[model samples]
Structure formats: C-alpha cells, structure tokens
Target: MATLEGPDVQASDGESDDGEDIPPLGENDNIDAIVESIWVQMAFDIMYVSPNPKDHRKPAYVLLDQEARTSTTPATFQRSDLTGIFRSVLYRELTSSQWETVVFDSFFPLPNSAALKRQGFRAASYYKKWHHLMARLRRRDIVVVRNELRRQFRTLLWVPHPDTDRMWRTRSSMRGFTRLPASSTGPCPLIAINRQALQGTRITLNPPIDDVEQGEMDEEDF
Candidate 1:
C-alpha cells in the first residue's frame, strides 16, 4: 500500500487562472507538452529559455515589449510569426521596383479551366498585360531578388526564440518548420486557434494596366 510522505503533487479539476486548465509545474510533461496546450496568440515577442552548458547559441532578438528599451533577455518567437518579416521585405522590394503584385496576379485568373482560349491565349485582356510584365523579368532579376532577400535576412541581429532553431551550433542553416521535426519549438498559436478555413481564396481586384511600366528597353524579352 502507498502512503503519503513528502509534499505530493495534487491534480486539479481543470481549474486555473481565468478558468484555464493548466497542468501543474513539474519536469513531468516536458516543455513541448506545455507549449502545445497553450491556445493563445503566438505573438510572443519575447521568451525565456533555461540556460544549459551544452547549448551554446543565443536568442537573436530582445523581448517584444522591451523593443523600445535595451534588454538582456532574448525574445522567443513562434515559427509562424516570421511571415510578417517575409511579407514586409518582399513588399518593400516590390514597392521599391514599382512592381504591382496585385496586378501581376491577374496573369492567372481563377475559376480558370480552359487553357489558351480560342485566340491561342491572346483573347484574354489580362494575357497581354501579364506577358508584358513577365517579359520584363530577366533571369538576373530573379537572382537579384533572391540574393537581396538572403542578404537582408543575414543582417538581422535577432535570433530565433529557440536556439535549436539555430541548431547546428557551428553550422549555418535556414529557420525551418521541417528541418527538425523533433526540435523543441515555441507554442504554435496560428494552428492552435479554433477557426474555420475559408471556403475559397480571396479574390484580388484587377488593377488598371496604366500602373505597369514599359520596363527597361531590352532587345530580347526574357
């Protein structure tokens, strides 16, 4: 028969601060389980990771709220939060080059089934605009875009919330959702939220063709 001795852990009936049902603090469930249970928005601009001698990497950025102020503690960010940075950099580059992604999207109209139409693809009014813009894109442009993005990311002083994200301590690698499936990760807020998926993708309005420039004069269209 088992007998009560030291302070034994007590189980709760799903009672927590703000009615949250939190598991008691212990080394039992592991950080991953605790993180997985959290359904809050994964907008943490900061995080706290216990130090270990075996782990040598550091968090890249300061805590979110402490952005305006200097902080010794590094911020913890969820993998999905990086979408904002990606969008910002992409849009900025596009805007700088006066590329209207919205209009560029018209190249492939949706609910689309028929290919090449009866006019051999010229019948669609958007086809002309799409080709005109695409023709301006040279192989160099693609390379330059890719290079610029890589360079900008390298310049970021911030570190991933989980150092394991920057794993391969001595080697360089891209932040990943797949590289390390078993890697310890921040709570996934985007996936945790209970929401219904959209029935269909949002429709982008067709902008005027006047916004598109003739682009640089090239002897051969790419």
Candidate 2:
C-alpha cells in the first residue's frame, strides 16, 4: 500500500489567497480540537478495513461510529476506527481503475455466480456482460463524491502525534483531544455525542454547571 504524507502547511508563493483571515492560534489551544471540529462540521463517517478471511490480501470495509471511543484513558482507537483516514486518502490518490480494483476486488469482493443469483441478477447474463456494464458507468462519477472526504481526512491527519500522558487524544489526529493540563482533574465534557446510537440520550464531556462556575472553569482551563 502506498502511503501519502500529510499536506504541507507551509505557504508557497504561487498559492492563491482565499481572502479569509487565518485566525491566530488561541492561547492553550492545540491542533487536535481544530481538526476534530473540522471533522464534526463536515460530518465525516469513519470506516475500518479488515483483511478478508478468505484472502489476506483482500480487504473489507467495516463502518464504525465517528464518535465512538475504544477507551477513555490515554485514549486509543481500534485499527478499524482509523481505517477511514486510510481509505479516503487511498481513494483520492489511486487511479479510477486502481480504486475500482481496491474497492470491488479487495475491499468488497464481487459476488460470485451463486451469490449473484441469490441477489436476483441472472448470474450467467450478468457475468457475461459485467465488463460492458462497468464500462458504461464512468469511474469519475463514482469517485467524485469522495474528493471532499479525502480532503478532510488529509487535513485531520496532517498533525504530528503528541506526547502521550493520561489525557485522551483525538484518534485521527494522534494528539490530545483537549488542551487541558495533565494535572487538571476536572471532568472534560464528552466531545459531541451520538444521540441516536445511545438510545436518544445525550452524553456530554462535562455535566451542566452554574453559569458563573462554567465561566470560571472555562477561564482557568483556557
């Protein structure tokens, strides 16, 4: 598998200005929160790739919750949780033919004749015309939707991993999830929760507190 390095942050003379002012990094803020916010804002979904039992070289996609955490202490992510970043980057960089092979042949093996029959496609006819059918559907159309996803993945993974402590780190960015000091014992509110997944109940990193207390806590933390 080819690995792509994260985007270069350095500005080049040929780069065009978007006219938006780059906000100065706030005091005590780290790169992790910024990247997480971007992912949340974009509503990117997470995916995991696992080797097929039938063939180790073939991979399969296992979708996962974007907000799910494997652990709370020194936060860690399952290999499956991080596959989204890898898939997105690979899809963006690979040629259409290569992408198709990766997705259909490896990630999702095409159904065999017996399986195709079960799915209601005439196995014989479908198999005979498979190449022609694929040729009719432009790979560009299928792959275009992934472009934004790939961009977001690259941005999130651009940050270098931070030194590990007891603090939870962002799975994708490999950095502390919050800028809170290691010594601070205050409960940090959960990053946004998935209400639907939790039976419609919300889980917050921090519990509700009085406005004055909240203000004071925010000041001290930041």
Candidate 3:
C-alpha cells in the first residue's frame, strides 16, 4: 500500500486534546511496536550497506540474542520478525523528518581494512549504501510534498567492532602474541625476552665465549 507522507498523530509526543501528558501506551498498543521496530529497522538499514550484509548475518542474530538475554522485564511488544517488525513500525509511524534523522543518525561509519574484514563493512561503502536507501525512502515518502531535505550528509565511525566473536578472537590472539617484561602487566618476562631475541635475531653467548668456543659448541649449546 502507498502510505501517505502526512504527520501521524499517534507518533507525536504530546499533551492530548485535553492538554494533559499523553497516557502511557499499553503493552498491547501498536504504537509501542512501531517505536521499537523503527530502531531495529534503522539498524538493518545500516547493515545493508556492507560488502556482504548476509555474510555477517551473525551480528544481527547476536544483537537479537543479547536483547533476549538482557530483557528480564516485560517488553511492551514481542520482536518476532526483527527486520519485518522494524519495517512495519517505521513505515507506519515515522514522519519524513523523523526518517531523515533516523537514517542519518543511526549508522556508524565503516572501519579500516583490518577492521572491515572483521566487521564486513567499510565506511565509504556504508555511506554510499545509506545514501541510496535514503534516496529510495525520499521518493516513497513524497519528499517534495513534505518539503524535507537531507543535510549534514556524512557517515560516522563506531568503536568496538560489531562482531563479538571477531572482537574476542582478536583479543585472544593479542594475548597469545604479546609478551610482557618484568615491569609490565603480565607475568612472562623471560618468555618475552626469548620472543624478542627470536623476533629481532638478538643472540647471546653464555660464559662470554669467543668465536672459537662458539664455533666448537655442541648441538646442545643451541
């Protein structure tokens, strides 16, 4: 169905016709669904810009899992179809102005190559994708009639890569790769010295041996 670009009364935060704070929406109310779904949809929109949106599908699943894990309290609405839920809600409630804000604000810029492989997204790619989606939405929302224009055209960077597994995997590798000196935080000074010697070809002869003694050393000397 072609949705109109007019302002939705339900979406406005306001005093009602009686000039009182709008009654808190009930769990059964569809408005709550719309609000929650808009956020998820925004997240999905950002994800779509990556080199491989489906390639990193686990992030969304992880996001959903985290939501499920942390949601101890009763939620106003169930997130059954995460992407669909977001689309339905955002399409139904958000004004053109709101949509512009959401599209621009919700995304974090893609990271560098090392980070990109880990994240499956690049900043330039994300910006381009988001720009395309915005154009499509603008046409659908009747941008001309709404007198809406997208300004502050740019993407942003987000710290802490989106993939939890990738992040922890990197951290684990760091732990394995790094060696601490006696004055450092970790308790592996000798190991660090050995690794340093191996890395930079730092060699030492025990007992201040001369070249002759070193050359004559047995296989066990190594």
Go through the candidates in order and give the C-alpha RMSD of each one to the true structure.
26.1, 22.4, 21.2
Residue 198 CA displacement from its true place in model 2, Å: 32
Tens-digit lDDT string for candidate 3 (63-144) = 2233433342212122122231111110112233433343322232211112333233333343333332232232333232
Candidate 2 lDDT tens digits, 1-222: 111112322122221122222333234433344333333422221111111124444332222333432211112211113232221111012233433332223211221212222221222232223322222222342133234334333322111121112111122221224322222232221121111223433222221233337668889998
* Weakest 10 consecutive residues of candidate 1 by summed lDDT: 189-198
Q: Estimate each model's TM-score.
A: 0.16, 0.18, 0.19
Candidate 2: where is the Cα deviation over 4 Å? 1-139, 152-179, 186-222
Span of 10 residues, lowest total lDDT, candidate 3:
84-93
TM-score ranking, high to low: 3, 2, 1
**Cα lDDT for residue 85, candidate 2:** 25
Alpha carbon lDDT at 10, candidate 3: 25
Which residue segments of model 3 deviate by more than 4 Å? 1-38, 42-118, 121-132, 137-159, 162-169, 173-222
Each prediction's whole-model lDDT (CA): 0.24, 0.26, 0.27
Error of 3 at 11 (Å): 23
Indicate which candidate wins on TM-score. 3
lDDT string, candidate 1, 119-212, tens digits: 2233433333323222222334323333433333222222222221221121122332222112223222111100111122221112112212
Comparing 1 with 3 on TM-score, the higher-scoring candidate is 3
Please name the candidate that would achieve the greatest lDDT relative to the true structure.
Answer: 3
In the predicted model 1, the residue pairs found to clash are 45-64, 46-76, 47-76, 60-158, 60-159, 61-159
